[model samples]
Target: MNDHDGPTPGNLVATVRAVLPSLTPAAQAIARLILEDPAMVARSTITEFSAVSGTSEATIVRTARALGFAGYSQLRFALAAAVAREEPERLVPGDLGPDDPLTDVIAKVTRAESEALADTAAQLNPDRLGTVVEAMVAARRVDVYGVGASGVVAVDMAQKLMRIGRPGHAFADAHLALTSAALMGQGDVAVGVSCTGETPDVIAPMQLAHKGGATTVAITNNPRSSLAELADHVLVSAGRETAFRPGALASRISQLLIVDCIFVGIAQRTFETSQAAVRATRSALDEYMADTRRRNK
Candidate 1:
């Protein structure tokens, strides 16, 4: 393995650029490919990457080593970690440690959010997103399945989609979710939300939906996850992991952004229909709220 140290080759794009003035032309070309889009590099095999980046295989190894990876595999792993780190919410204005002054926490959180945006912007696949958006727009029905924190996001997605006139549902329970999946058929769409993409509940429903001729999409921090493989398309979220850090906050925020983006895209594509749906949803909600208020009084 090429051994070099910051994060991954992709995470170090800015660092590579800062040092580019000192690098050879071949190295510069390789650096450009990684910086331009790390996911592209992550998806590529060494031989394929070398040819596309116009650098020799040896140069690729050197580049990975320069990035502080033991080799290409290590480089990829580093990229995964970097992606994970960006998957959370931006730190709020004053969330720094007690030992840190208010200003320090503010600065740290600001930097964290900025980095998260940058990582997600860099990591997002427009083409893949477009494909999923299209599927969502054309689907006969939509179902979202997730467990735990991810289940919450799935419900949020369903709520938003419902507002836009889409017939969507979120199942927090695994057995009911699998049953829901059985009800899906051709031309429908199913989405699974799992930060780890390993939850059996989410996977079972997603798999069942797919087998029923529904198009399945997996949104997760782990692209290599079993859920991701079960999906017809995958949307990746940026996430970060630290020894003392919790994965919930940031990962949820990142996933929410992606979900919101998809919802908006669908709304735009069906603007008039969505508007009507929104109106209907508001009416339904108003009636339900009034009934509950009356019963309580």
Candidate 2:
């Protein structure tokens, strides 16, 4: 409800999930109906959909607007487009049962990861990604912030940037993140990584960095989330999780893919410098590898 931009229309399912937490109960019922059977929703009339969702026509319109659509008509068009683009081979993991076999578990998890990656790629706005990359390349320093599982992603991103001759630091601790962000000023970039985009530990530092005159970017699934509201750029990821997995594996895979995209974009812009820095870093690790080999022998 802040000044954040609405969701993109290219990937309706991802958009639905991203905004699910913020939807009103009546709107959420309609959202769930669409999510469960997008193809059916695409063909259903407004009257038919209202009956299926057990909500009023007005609530359905609100749900459509909440998802960044103009109204039910636009939402229907987007859903139709999405259903048309759906791949036959693509797998959607159902609720896992306790007695599921190991093979089934592997299949389902891998399928979820695959779908998350594909959906994220489809929904990602290239122009936004380019803007973030350009900002990072010109930044005097970069500060990455995340908490919980996202903390690992932040660290990975910092390492990638550092290896490309960029000076960057990652903070997983809330206090340290705030302290580091406080020191940032103009020409610096602060990146916040959070799946839900509502983590106070991540959002607080990002807000601080913004107030301190640094450019802020949010890598999250929800484009309208609190962190996104404060960001200069928002890079969204997509993932669907079962109750058992929660936001664990699928979100990580999607976030890592976006991280890799940003890293590669920056590297491409600073080609010779990035190549040299990567080689130097690799060379510096040779001695440790040699020592380990000798000890093993």
Candidate 3:
């Protein structure tokens, strides 16, 4: 496939330039609209673009088809990717400025979540994530190890997997984690979550697990991080850098989303087993709560 074959909404400007001359007058008009305002193309649907460009939906589809995508979805994805690359500093909408009034916390949180969703879209690699999930699903056991703020996310993932009857542990202590890592073998899975991906404490154990022949998964903000390089499968977290604002917020949120994605994938793939596990776990918790209530009474 040539460069044009993988056109994303982000590269619509380039695609328009490359294909404009070849298109008929009607298609060229749509191309002009896209180049003039690629963000509009990124934010709007094909039908909306067609209406705003004064062209028919068929014309838009034909234009995208001519540009080498299977359909309009591919074209829009390309456009959004291109736009995201251009703006490295765009906070999620309402997060544009800091120091808002106390009453605006809700709006701020909403914007932050919106940005998280967009970052997830811009950075996620479905193929890579699927591979990691597959490894977790087939593993004999799973170990989740992390340190610092990422450690919290690791523990949260462990709890969720436990509910689904996956035998896993989240290790916060360096020594205990290393010992557990030494026990990992082929068919086991070891996960390391680190935003910077350079934490020595987290990497040391994951490296041992990798050497033990276990399938390793690393969820990190940096795709090029040492953690990603060490693990067999990498789940990337999309987050923005900020000053005075802790990486804790963005990194943890992204990590949570990554865990959620993996959990959902595993649940869908092992529907019956996961459902039974969930039910059993919930029942156990209810029974424990009932016993506590009776004692109090």
lDDT of 1 by residue, 190-291 (tens): 999987778899999988998999999988776656887888887766554333345635577778878988998899899999999888889999999999
Clashing pairs in 2: none
Model 2 lDDT at residue 150: 89
For candidate 3, write residues 69-160 as lDDT tens digits.
77777777776776777732341234434676756866665556556555655555677778878888998999999988889989999998
Candidate 3 stretches with Cα past 4 Å from truth are 1-100, 103-106
Instruction: State the C-alpha lDDT per candidate.
Output: 0.73, 0.85, 0.75
TM-score of each: 0.64, 0.92, 0.68
Query: Highest TM-score, which number?
Result: 2
Query: In model 3, what are the clashing residue pairs, if there are any?
Result: 8-78, 8-79, 9-77, 9-78, 9-79, 9-80, 10-78, 10-79, 10-80, 10-82
Report the C-alpha lDDT of model 2 over 1-297, residue by residue, as the tens digit: 124344444566677888887788898788877777878888999999988888999999989999988899888888777777673124234656798898988888887887789778877778788988999999999999998888989999999998889998999999999999999999999999999899999999999999999999998987878988899888888876567787668898899999999999999999999999999999889878999999999
How many steric clashes between backbone atoms does each model show? 14, 0, 10
User: What is the lDDT for 273 in model 3?
Assistant: 99
